[model samples]
Target: MDTRNKKRLGAMLLTGIVSLSAIASGCGNNAADDANAGANEQPANAATENAVAGAGMKDGKYDPPITITYLRPWGPDVKFKDGENQDNNVHAKWASEKLGIELKNQWISPSTNNAFETKLRLSLATNEPMPDIISYRGDFNLVRELIDSGRFVDAGELFDKYASETWKKAMDEDPSVWYPYMQDGKRIGIPILDYAYNGDPVMWIREDWMKKLGLSAPKTLDDLEKVMDAFANQDPDGNGKKDTYGLAIGFKNWINTWMSDAGWIFGAFGTMSNQWNLSADGKLEYGSVTPGAKQALATLQDWMGKGYLPTEAGLYDETKAAEDFTAGKAGIVVGPHWMPAWPLEDVKKNNKDAQYKAYPVPSGPNGQAGRHGTSNANGVVLINKDMAHPEAFFTYQNYLFDQFANPPIGGEFEYGLAEGYDWVMVDGKPTTDAAHTGGFAPEKYTITFDGARIPGLNMATLAKLADGGEAATPFEKKLKLSTPQTMLDAAKIVLEQKDITMQQLFTGAPTATMQMNNDILAKMEKDTFSQIIYGKAPIDSFDAFVEKWKASGGDQITREVNEWYQSVSGGQ
Candidate 1:
């Protein structure tokens, strides 16, 4: 990347290096005040005092606990134990007693789209004092703007100083993972990592329905079509009501999603929607504009005409579309391995005879199958420049990685995060099921913390077990105990077909042109595709849409995307 582009990309992608303010909070003896107390000293001496004040004594615990303020987005589903709230959760108590750190919430917003963003924008516009730490699962552009405002700290130095080797290794799985959180060669934001294969899309079909129809699981696109035809027309449910659909999918928004996602169908044709993929010529090209995408759209149109797809699919969102599947009115749905925990599991609740199994997406005519890949890093942790102790944050975080994520042998967290909360002793053996959580139900009512995960832990464990190995670690054991056999089987299929996973080639922020005109182009694509599938527009309308896309800002976006791709790939 060019020097200026590097800086631009850094600032655009992540937060920035920051200088701390020498301000004291409720504490009569804060590091910030301690540093300023020696103001008559030399410049070099003052610099030393400032650094010490920002970090505090690194003796594993503070004599007097220091408080760290933060903001949280509370979800509607959020619950608390009988006597426990966000301010007094098990995790908070652990931190206070073990690390001598206090957590204080500045304010919490409902965890809905635009809720936190709205509050955060107002706070930023007013130039209100930021909390000690702020974490967001999304809104990268907002974080970028905040980084530009120079209110956050450069976490690079602090991480280098305090992050344990285990934590560092977790981040090192892919060094480029840090690029999204870097600014001017400084890692300004800490990435909250997730499993790499969590987003791997799979086909979930009703096993009982397949057997009732005497159809085997599909391995090819033709076989899949045959199965869908049987499912839609043969009344596999045996309820004597022509009510079932062959497939359930939604297109109210983008085709790509975690539940009932249509990305794999496009992938079967060697393309995916809402992303850029490397073309045969080795250039990043928009997936939706490709000929393969048009062919996929045509297939979907045929499916709809044949009554293989739910009639109201266009009106449903991801989860809403799966209601038919849960109600046993649809036999097939596509989603991630975790679908068993959601709408699929609800199938058994509604109909005890419903037996669903997951399979790899059936191969296309070209003898290939594909699914969209997931980005490992999901959210970022931002710290305020005026915060007294970045090291304390690192301390708490590293402990989470080491103990909670990858606990050493004979560690306290081997069974679960907290006994009687996440797990309880049943017959003198630890169990993670909700049956044992008493009334606490820690999983549903998380009080301690949010937004941190060990990248690749769950997938790695499942892969190992799929290969005929026993759970070797506590984390693996917990996962093995909790996840269903169907999901594990699906994970094996996903792992076996890993080579077919397609990922977005461009990971940079939206270019100026894209930010300006991408929404218009997206609307055009959705409307054109939906219209064609519904028989409202000629298939040739795809060509018109393509031309319009290119004539708009798409060409500029493509050029900028290629520039970013080349920069990241060392000008390859």
Candidate 2:
């Protein structure tokens, strides 16, 4: 969390806050600097022109070494493993050799929930010369602040002039990528691309139990009840014990907490994210207090009443909830396809014969089953002003994103970061198999959300990939074996059923109302919902809570959100 959120729980007393002043629009202006540049030119070493001309540039050579400082946020998992020098990593080495670029260490923070943002803001506040390029993956608010400062140059021309064909093609593939980085009409940084279906969630189940119980896959809410009943009472664990539960869900402060983690359940009963398709209107609608949300809550109440869900689920952190699923105490859960890699994969170790699979969430009462999620489009990139050679950053970044990030063909990527660091060569091959990933960041290396080798996918295949199944390639094959067929199948069903779902159109900064009421409203929703499920609160409380939600800034938030949605839809 940032200092703002930190003040509440009040964790640690901060060291200090740095404040920066605005300088003229160029990099560190000094009159003596021009004299130094003129003296260092050395007449361009005339012979170099022949070589540079052959390389397809105006001159045979560009003289003088220029340094670019870059920043990226990584945590403990990336603490320079295998006796590697702290100053150098695979990425820095590649940048130096291939692009004639030298990247100075800016510093690496813990990469915690909001540590990156804190670090970024502090750096921005300091007047010490800013880095020539900043790969900002922190927050949009910070990005906006950076643009408004005008210290960095606009990248529109740089991208057009310097981006490689491959990189250009990728950007062309997704026009919306530029939306978040745009301020007034200027593009400040390149938008980072991620899987289009990164938001899709899948229903993971213990397939062996389904087979043993002779139970067909669940389609409707009624069928889901049967499955949950079988899971809870049928002794699915077969340890000859009744200690098992139907599913796992948690309510924690971490990302993908209760609302984040349990959104699928609501999505199934139908309340996930701020987006939904209302039966009353063919147009998309928010789901918070809609009728479908009420139904979803009702289902939660029923599950809690029947003891099908954990009584203590409301207190579960994401880690604890995943453990319940992994320990074989819960027969079903929902998560992304990569669950087999980190959080959910422990099931194999816990019970070697446990049959786990991914399947679609059970259909809703009106056959409107859908999962909710948001896509990632923005990270951070560095920008330069008055570059004698403005093209270098673009070319280097393009090569990194195209050949390195989304390799067209299978090739060893430069930004591989490091093999043994995050991935390892098992028998001379790239394997995303967790066993080979040694020295990964303690928090990440093993997790799919970080730098892990996933397989090839195009926009068209996103729905299919999100559906989960057999690995798209040899790399994904290892992932598939560890994950269950049901997991993959569930992902496919959810992706294929996208027609019934609507991702929240508002993907920008939090509105003022959200800033004021987001925390309280969320806490109210979770507390009330949890109470109703645990039988601590009457069902009517949901109605009262809804009224409170609307009265307490929710109405204002809704209006602002719809305004954004309409703006994005061109007022359609």
Best by lDDT: 1
- Global CA lDDT computed for model 2: 0.54
User: Model 2: per-residue lDDT, tens digit, 1-572?
Assistant: 32122221111111000000000011111211321232223232232333233333343222344455556655433445565433465555655665565656556555677786787778778855556666655455677777767777778666766555544544554455565566556677766544444435567788888899999888777887898899899888777888988878865442233111566556665556434333344344557677667777777888878878887787786558778888888888876544554456678898788777766666776666666543434255657564444455554454444443333324453213456654567787765454666534321221111331111132223223334433343223333334344434444554455454445455545668988888898888767777777778887888998899899998888777666545444444
**What TM-score, over all chains together, does every model reach?**
0.85, 0.75
Residue range 1-572, candidate 1, lDDT tens digits: 22113222222222111000000011111211222222112121122223444445345565578788887566554556767776788767877887678877788787566798899989999999999888765566776777777888887777766666556656666455655666665778777665556657789999998888899889988899999999989988887888888988987866766567788888889998878898888899999999988988888889999999988878987778888899888899987666676657789888897899988898889987888876556567888899877666776666666566545435767776678776788898877666667534343222222323545455655655555667656655666676667766776676667778887667666678888997798789889989988878878888989999999988889998887766656544
Q: How close is candidate 2 to the true structure, as a TM-score?
A: 0.75
**Could you tell me the lDDT of residue 67 within candidate 2?**
55
Best by TM-score: 1
